[model samples]
Target: MITKILPGTNIELKSGARDADLSVTGVVAMALPLHWGGRVTVIHAGDNTLYPLGYKISDPALKLVREVMNGAKQLILYRLNTVGAKASAEVSTGVTAEAVFPGTRGNDLSVVVSASGEKWLVKTYFGTQEVDSQIISAAADFSPYYVALSGTGTLAAATVKLTGGTDGAVESDYTGFFAELEKREYNVICSTDSDRAADVVSFVKEQNANRAYVQGVVTGVHPDSEAIYVCNSTGGVTADYELTPAESCATLAGLIAQAGVQTSLTYHRGITGWTDVKPHLTIDQQTGRTQNGEVLFVPLYGSPSVLYDITSLTTFDEDHPKDFGKGLVMRTLQKYQSDLQKLLDTRCVGKIRNSVEGRAQIKAMVFEMTSRGYLAPGYMEDFSADDITVTAGTERDAVSVVVGIKAVDTVDKIYVTVTAL
Candidate 1:
């Protein structure tokens, strides 16, 4: 059975449990963090805590968050350092007001001070909408939700627009983010900054090499690696917002994370709220880009849809065949890898004896997980008990297992022949 563990941790699977029973699918991590609080914030489906935490609807970070929430059930928002300066304004002598959160979103705020009889009325406006207001005799006693007030002096009646708010630098370097992200678990990690495409790909490669088993979605650059998915479309327009290529990358990441083992992204699935794709390409262009290992969005069956669910791996070898380029197969393999790792880390390792009986027990566990967990759920086909092998390892305390699985993929194309009689 699937059980909820600690607050920050994802669901854990009990022994002999089906991977689909407790599989933490669609867990997405956002490279950018909100300005309001904490270096990391975990948002679950239908969670509106961001609004109460001072995140505005118009914030650019929220756009990515909203798009991710459209598909993925959970999102981890991480920030490296206190990147931006807070917007502030001097109302009068010894009286100052600062935004509750840092970043360029604060620049949209303005503070208006009006006389209220013997007291002072301070109002915080986000583009003419009063978000917070307070009336008090002194600045120290004034408490507002949107802006923090400081200093002690006589308040004057004036309107001051907060300035000097900046978004800071794009996270082109992932040195800090990777250090912390290594401790977390997620199905997909997305970079919302297209300029950092190369850096993101490099990070994903290193993480995968270390057996992190996480997928990455990035825009612009093509590394031709199985660990990374590249988006090449531009000028996307959604019903609620105009999207940059980077934003579209985040949306795709969410979709990839949410897709179950039985589903394919290109299975007649369109973006949740997309209205149009920019620089519409012809059928030949779509085929050319798909062959180049780039993901593209085009009009399909009268709606904007992903052209193909493929990765950036064009080069193929015995180990990495052409079918490895299919995103669905890769996701299934990664899920198995992650599940096996979790099983070993949690149940075996130093706890289990390294004897023949112990090895057989381990083999049985793997067999059940492979057949009952994966094959029975239609995630894989052509699996047999003979495909799993368990033996003692070269080390005295280690055991080894070899498993073969054929992942299932959705049918996206059909061919029909008509003979006139």
Candidate 2:
């Protein structure tokens, strides 16, 4: 059954079970940086903090929505008390020691089962910003005892000798080892050091072109590596079905854009293979997706455009009227084809007021304005959640706008078209 995160309530997280029980600890569906409306539902769980008020499962098709690793550190409780409970007696966690995970894009969820045939489903989060299939894209070796190694072909350079445990066939050749990789039924995280990441890119590109390759966004991307790193974005020059050349990264700005009125969205990255991985920032809600037209990413410091859409922590209460900013921010970092707000700030004839409640409120306000064309550059309409002071002679506060993160009964997916410069 699907778990629901009701609007307008603050709840702490505990632990949960995979099948019928979810621990008392609220399950975190997606990571942080997620924007929710009053009715948004959660698909994952996490340790106690504040979970949007949650409800129990009633649907079976969505039962396995979140990945459940067999040996990961999750809990196995039947349920918890008031979702907002701050009590410790109602919490528990799994102590298994295996590398299994699950990840999801939209409703598409998959798990990373280990070489030991352990199954998993990482709890995923959908952020206010858009997520792409791209990531750090570095692969390393998982030696005996979950050992980590570097450099490509290292498995070929050495023999893996297993003592006290059942060992399978060993390959002394790198090519042979990798070929065996494709044949293995389990999702094995194998890696070897390489002087340049270019070779890694070549290997991925040679593997497939139609389908975007999976880069290790989390595992091993860093600067000052004693080992080499490479850029592997090269591929056939076919135009991105959803993007144009003008929308490509002009600097360190990577982007994920929408192309149709409401397009199908997906997330792909190496988060699944992270396996008790290292230092990484957790952003974006695990199961939440953005309004159809929203874009999300990090931007250059001096970017002439708006980056970082802060839509987390919005409160959506039904009895209370929530003035939601239809569309406010873009989540992706890149050279944007359309600066939805910049166009509004200067073009619209209303004074910009910070009437929103929180960091997330501002984003909610902006989004609300954009969706109704009040925030568009060409329009002069005003929006409001509440009546406010006008600078003496300024245009009467159009609509005293207030925003919260409750999904509209008739929410629409957003999209944008890319044009090559």
Candidate 3:
């Protein structure tokens, strides 16, 4: 052997790490008692912004937040304020203060100032309960939820109660809200109001088409839309807060956040521990509505629980039958497609050629998922090596792939027959 200078080859081993990031996260948008507008924020478990409650809607997102923190690993929140809402305010001798945000929650604030030694004691009250107190020698030192102080007038022995804080007619800034939401990724999107139910459903459909699939849960009935789950909740007034159809939607959002994609909320409790059916309906009504793809919170074992895990899909097309209307099946399909896309991006993009090796890689991925039960075995019944095709596209520097997938549906019902022997 001749000892000649040779170049060394670098060999590296690489593998793809599986991620469940999208499967365990959820997003909810609603009116909150915070700075208004279409402001979007992310809150994991134990965030202080949701603390020191003061308003009735203080934790407007309390239902969704609590469930996500306890169940789902992450959550995205949107605080929506109606356009042109007036902030509540109180004018005192030496101080002028306004509510932090525009909402009827501000009308409940009361501000009182008293002399304490060398400093003036300013106290903030939320419907008779003192929530904040500050010692101040001048207006600049006053900071409380009841008011934002200003001016040089004497605050000594002065009390001012807020009034005229009208909550702007409830209007949803769907245009702004959706614009902000589309930038983020989430497993589920939940909203209570039906005002923009069509928009929400349409957005989810668009996301799916773009290969960024997301599911939605809504309250009240909406026109049939795939990937959108509908639930009919009570619109009755309760002692603490009115149980509107929207609030019902929020409750379902929280439930979905905690439960796994493979898990069903059927027979699960509503977020508020509410177990009794309000505006009480008979069994026949609940059954009929659910069969029509309405998610009802009916009494199960004398406890309030979800009636079914259904989607707003009533397709009559042969290609997409009613059986594919089930929420569980759609979710399974979404996850399956997501995995396939990931494989393409990570394992096939530039490293693999659009040849036999590339096709084998695609087939191997499908085999792995099916073996692990992510995809049903039925998919492999007639699927041969030719089932996966990775070919060069007509477009410059483009490749195309064709894949066939089959999903196993959740066994919602079963019929059994027995005869006396």
Candidate 4:
């Protein structure tokens, strides 16, 4: 008698883990690459201050960082090289010093060497303030925080100021930034350069098509796409700070990033750290701007608040309803899509078999996940088990899943009637 050989039973375990939080804001700016040597750096919750990260207050990126942190806790900064010149100075014989980073801010740096008895005192100054000082016995033992040292020799007492530093030309093409940005997950992106409006719109559209679900915030130019938010307010000067239109875009991006799926940035949503907006718009002006799909900082309830959480999507078809223009609804939809994709990629993609039972399992899993994650939190409503369907595709290895969801929106308007008897 011959016995047939059988394949061993394989048990694949699936994880019930969820994706990372979707509340990160990305900033693409022409910033000096100081301590972080790479093109990208992530600033955690408490480390939002630029001075601690080797960035002076005079740096061009300082304002952008401050504006973004005013609303968001976490930030991912993309360093756009300006092709600028580095500031350097020759200090005494056999010693040369250069700014730690490039750009015009380095031009404010100066190196002063003074004789310190048995040792040498090297002081690095930013204008009149002495930022860094190191007492060293020899050039080889010298280490400075603000500048890099080269060409070692006997130390001498002299003062040398950095020169020939320039900001150079800002990059017009954002192909590289977009490529690197796609590798990471962020809810919103904004650039300090208003000139990159068209490129930013194109990037947002491509990303949304791929289901990446990121929004772009810009100023001035109007690109009527649901994926883009245009800030049209001609900024304002507060008591402590003055903002331009581009800076306002960064602030709006931050606010959008911090807003959860359950919240809407309308009426009651006020910009953090800003008390008022200058040159307030009239009622008619606000109405006209809103109709044009522009976001404005208007006075609401005696405070500077968002007029409406709107996107530049004036032309809407049946597939893209008027609700799609609302930032709150878009956030809810993007979160759901991103989370579902993550669930499939992690749990169901290669592990599940292409059978009726597997399809049923997928549908049940998605329904339960949505109920617990979204419905329970009030981000979504009117969802039922029938809203999700998983079916077999033409290819045996492929599966098609269709999900329908009703995102909950905030009540921004009310009408009341009073009759006197």
User: Which candidate number would show the highest TM-score if scored against the true structure?
Assistant: 4
lDDT of 1 at 58: 39
TM-score per candidate, in order? 0.81, 0.16, 0.70, 0.84
Error of 4 at 334 (Å): 1.0
Q: Candidate 1: deviation at residue 180, Å?
A: 2.7
Candidate 1 lDDT by residue in tens digits, 128-208: 777778888888897756688899777899899988765555454777777778888788888867777787788777877
Go through the candidates in order and give each one's C-alpha lDDT: 0.77, 0.23, 0.61, 0.75
Candidate 2 regions with alpha-carbon error over 4 angstroms: 1-255, 259-264, 267-345, 348-371, 374-421
Lowest lDDT block of 10, candidate 2: 83-92
Return the lDDT, model 2, position 335.
10
Q: Report the C-alpha lDDT of model 3 over 71-146, residue by residue, as the tens digit.
A: 4445676666544353545456646777655556667777778889988888888777787898988887766454
Candidate 4 to truth, TM: 0.84
Q: Model 4: runs farther than 4 Å from truth?
A: 1-41, 48-61, 79-81, 112-123, 128-144, 157-159, 192-194
Per-residue lDDT of 278 in model 3: 66
Estimate the overall C-alpha local distance difference test score of candidate 3. 0.61
lDDT of 4: 0.75
lDDT of 2 by residue, 1-421 (tens): 3455886656667775212211112111111111111112222334331123211122221112112211112212111111111111100121111211111111221112122223221121222222112111222323211211234331111112111111122222234323433432111111222232234334434432322212111112222111111111211111111111111111101111111112111221221212221111124421232221122221123222212222221344663222221222111100111233233344333544433333234444356444453224323234344322212223434433223222211223368899999
Instruction: Quote model 1's TM-score.
Output: 0.81
Ranking by lDDT: 1, 4, 3, 2
Question: What lDDT is reached at residue 105 by model 2?
Answer: 15
User: Across residues 1-421, which tens digit of lDDT does each residue of candidate 4 receive?
Assistant: 2344787665666776554443333333223233322356676555724334445433444656767766666677765654667788888677888876666767778988899999989998877888878998876777756677788677789899998766665455777777778677777878656678888888888888988878888877878888889986646455567787677887787778777575788985457667777558899988888888898887778777888888999889998899999989988888788788878777788988989999998898789879998999998899999899888999989999999999999997889899999
